[model samples]
Target: MAACIVEPILSSGGVIDPPAGYFAALKRKCEERGMLLIVDEAQTGLCRTGSWYAFERDGIVPDILTLSKTLGAGLPLAAVITTAEIEQAAHDRGYLFFTTHVSDPLVAAVGVTVLDVLQRDGLDTRAAQAGSALRAGLLELQERHECVGDVRGRGLMQGIELVTDRATKQGADRLGSAVTARCFELGLHMNVVQLPGMGGIFRIAPPLTASDEEIRTGLDILDTAIAECVSAAV
Candidate 1:
């Protein structure tokens, strides 16, 4: 029997650090059970979380690392990084896979340009700093708006959780959807998430190239939408 474990750092509409002893425990368990640990950094990789890979922040390396999302910078690309041992194991079984249109030169060029821009413009550092500022501002907004229950995330990836009851922390799905629609109407694209076992959380992940002024403008529009929704609900 083979097993795989997928652990992501998402909680309370925020990206909480993984459990204090999660990595150590996972290493021990995986070694004992002979299971593979796969880290999926599709959404959290490519300096989106202030690090080349989010797992780097946890100080643990996975047997298999999957990446996509921003890697191609709007082009279709995905990658799986693994150790030589794993590669040998797969090759020993004579498993060689090839795909059609694996790497279009045009897309590859775009990826190269994206990497250049990210390094030249210091987007990783900018994402960290700008994300911190955005989180702080959202926290202040939460204090001002009863509808805002929590603000959480890191780097360019953040979420604003809307709640109808502060005591119970119940999600206000309609309110969140309304706010997203309002922001879109106000010319700012935003996401309203609907995940199982989670409440209404607004997903805010702007392009890494977005300027500080663009972030502020988007947030201002969001503030207006949130306020308007709260007022209309009363």
Candidate 2:
């Protein structure tokens, strides 16, 4: 009741990045109301935003943070970070989520190893550089595709919005599905999040280890997918 939670970058919801100081203002308002600020980095954490945490760019720290998605390095691992004050309060109140293997030692060890690799190999910087190439390529795609309503995301995570009408910025759900299928057929598997009638949002999150060539190849496939889809529609 006294907490506000949000995804740093809207992923499945739309991959929308809020305006600058969005989170900082949100945290400020939450503090004013004596509420906790919780950031769900399920999609934008661990160098996805060209930073260790997306919130870093906003210059705000959440009282609680939730992480998942790529946290386990292809393993099913999630982590929650919170201020000691809130954590201690929960402990004092004996509040806990029921779980048996919630923090299995093996999985925890794996998480540690994953963190080590991420830090040791400098995958964060890798994501930044790789993301730059991918993002630039996506922007180029938008120039050629009338259906590309918007291009967004940061670091290794990027999204392209498809719209049937650029003036109204309407979503092109049907065309988006077609492009996805076409891309798959062309040997580049991808996903386009369909939010009912709103349209489809293509999420492009290449692995950090991906080479520059691979990123360019993916963008080329995506560009081809859009071209083919547009031609078919016409």
Candidate 3:
């Protein structure tokens, strides 16, 4: 097998965070099969998960690492990192990799600046602190709302699954759409998972630079939207 590529936290997959030591166990399985373990940190890297990378919490280093999204800070740039032995092997095999717009100095500079700011401003720690407040707010909402079936995630990346009935855990797909539309109308754009069987999952990822007041304001907007939508349903 070439490699097993995975997103440390399933962002579009309902923002699911794997259980503790999950990656460690997966890595062991990969080793047994003589396959390379590749971690894709496009959405969870650069302090998005309260750390430089979500895989750090797993305590296992991947054989290959891929990064993008936050790395360019909106620009189109990506990176692949691997150990010297693997890199040498690939080079010896004459393997070539390049994107349509490769070697752009402007984007490269932006990526460097992003790294500098993430480190200089201690955004990793900021993400952790902000995530704590965000999760607390989400939990409070879960307690107050019967439709909030589940709240799960880590750091600034979180998700809340809406259900018609919490006891059944059935996805409230239509209600999810309504709440998102209401949130947009209220000037707070919300993202809901579009996949079948996961349509009720709402992905809530606030910017790491957001202030405490901003986070609270967003939560308030979300609360108002959910309440309005649920009331309209009845």
Candidate 4:
């Protein structure tokens, strides 16, 4: 392949963080073939994955990096970053692409402010701390609830895969929606994904500004919802 594009952490498909050394090896393979390694950190960027960028966890750099979602801190803003060599090459080739949305000063200012706040507040560190606490809570849930087959992710972005049986890893596609609705009813909003082969996975991506109390409350709600659904099924 000339280039390979991948999500640093597969957020849409599932909150699946790649195994250790996966990206480093992938980068080598791309480099050997003289291919650009494009990383889509759109969902995992701006301290969402407990780091400034998800790729940083892999200890490698992407040739073309894409950022979004958190880039504007809730505003509609996105950006693509590349090395100077590529930018100079593109400029030399007279690559002209323009969009009104991309040039908006208001959005640009918002992006700057978002960066400033993230750095000044040490949100990356906050995300790490919060993620550890969240993961521990979810792990306890997995032990208590057989439906949560797996709990995996990094930083503030985490997930729990619903299953009917732990040994079989049977997907419980509808369970996510049930839990989601219940959690919402209890005052906690959550997102769930039902994908081919993967079944249902609930994503827990709380705001970086959320306090420890808020995080614990969300987890408590989630726990109650899942337990409620499983018991109802029984």
Candidate 5:
């Protein structure tokens, strides 16, 4: 295999975060096979996950790390990071890096400013604090709503899975749609996982800079939306 690419948190795949030491083991496997481990931190990087990188939790540094989304801070910018040895090897192999948008001064400045703000404001710590509140609220929802079968994720990125019955763990696809629509109507837009067998998974990744009051408001809105939707269904 050329390389093993993975997201520290499977954001698109129901925001699934593997257990601890998982990535460390995966990295060992990659090393044994003489393949590079490439971590795509598009969603979980740059303080979105309470750390600079989610893979840090596993204590393994990827051979190749790709960052975007958060780095742009709403603008369009991306970066690839690797050790000097790997970069030199690629250069020796005649690899050319060229992109029309590469090194645009305006976006580059924005990326720098984004990093500055994240550090100056301690957004990583903020994300961890806010995430605790988010997770707690979600857990409370799971307690009150039988359809809320699971709540999982870390830092600012969280997910709730709706099920027809918690015991059966059957996906409540239609209920998920209704809850999403209700949340939007209630002034809180939520993203539902579109993949098959995961339609009931709602991705709740609030901004790292979001205030505690904002977080509370969003949770209150979510609670109301879920209650209204579930009651309506009943």
Candidate 6:
């Protein structure tokens, strides 16, 4: 049996370019060891990463892919895309799994609507443009705040990594949590994620319908929150 390889994002800090030759090296390893490469695109799929899928940006394709979150347009749906061979393998095994109420007509309708909006409104192109602006804004913020260790990611799925000491790159989880709470209090909804055994990262993923002004406003609030946290800590 070939081993199953999973690459859960190159970095939790955000969608980076997966390090030069990272995908190629992984593909080579998989081919050599007879392994299957699986990509979990839960957060970076559906134009979130500037491209339809983040893996596409890297010029690498996975044996199997899993998608959810934005697929149902906030409704509840998930799907798996794989090769015909994989589907045939499942059939050969005579394995059948089904959920009684898995197919909700309402949710299916929403999925269709989501796809229409993505195509007609050009959300993917918007994501690419807005993402570039957001990333540039974040890089400027990092320059202003010494506590910011790294600002990385693609399209709308971006993150700001906070560190107490840039030299050591130690995670400032508490500060990140403080910023998140303050943003919420200020009426901006955002998320702060703590990667087990890694540094703290603040995720900035607004709805695809968010306006350019709204994106600027959210980042402004974040900048203020970071400044406030750094000031209070000192």
> Scored by CA lDDT, what does every candidate get?
0.78, 0.87, 0.93, 0.90, 0.93, 0.79
Q: If both were scored by lDDT, which would come out higher, candidate 2 or candidate 3?
A: 3
TM-score of 5: 0.97
Worst 10 contiguous positions by lDDT, candidate 4 = 191-200
Runs of candidate 3 with Cα error greater than 4 angstroms are: none
Q: Which stretches of candidate 1 lie over 4 Å from their true place?
A: 1-7, 10-17, 196-199
Clashes of each: 0, 1, 0, 0, 0, 0
Q: Global lDDT for candidate 3?
A: 0.93
- All candidates: TM-score: 0.89, 0.96, 0.97, 0.96, 0.97, 0.90
lDDT of 2 by residue, 1-234 (tens): 689999989888877889889999999899899999999998899877788899998899999999987788877889999989899999999997957779888888888887788899888898988888898998898888888989999898898899988999888888988988988998888867766774568888888788999988898999988998899899
Model 5 residue runs over 4 Å out of place are none
lDDT of 5 by residue, 80-151 (tens): 999999999999999998899988999989999999999999999999999999899899988888889999
Across 1-234, the per-residue lDDT of candidate 1 in tens digits comes to 354656445523344456546765776688799988887777877778777776776577889888777878887987778999998998998988788867678877887787788888888898888888788778888988988888877788888888998889998888887888888899988776657645378777788877888888988898899899889888
- For residues 56-97, write the lDDT of model 3, one tens digit per residue: 998999999989988898888898889999999999999998
Model 5 has how many clashing residue pairs?
0
| Span of ten consecutive residues with least summed lDDT in model 6 | 7-16
Query: Which candidate model has the greater TM-score, 1 or 4?
Result: 4
Global Cα lDDT for candidate 5: 0.93
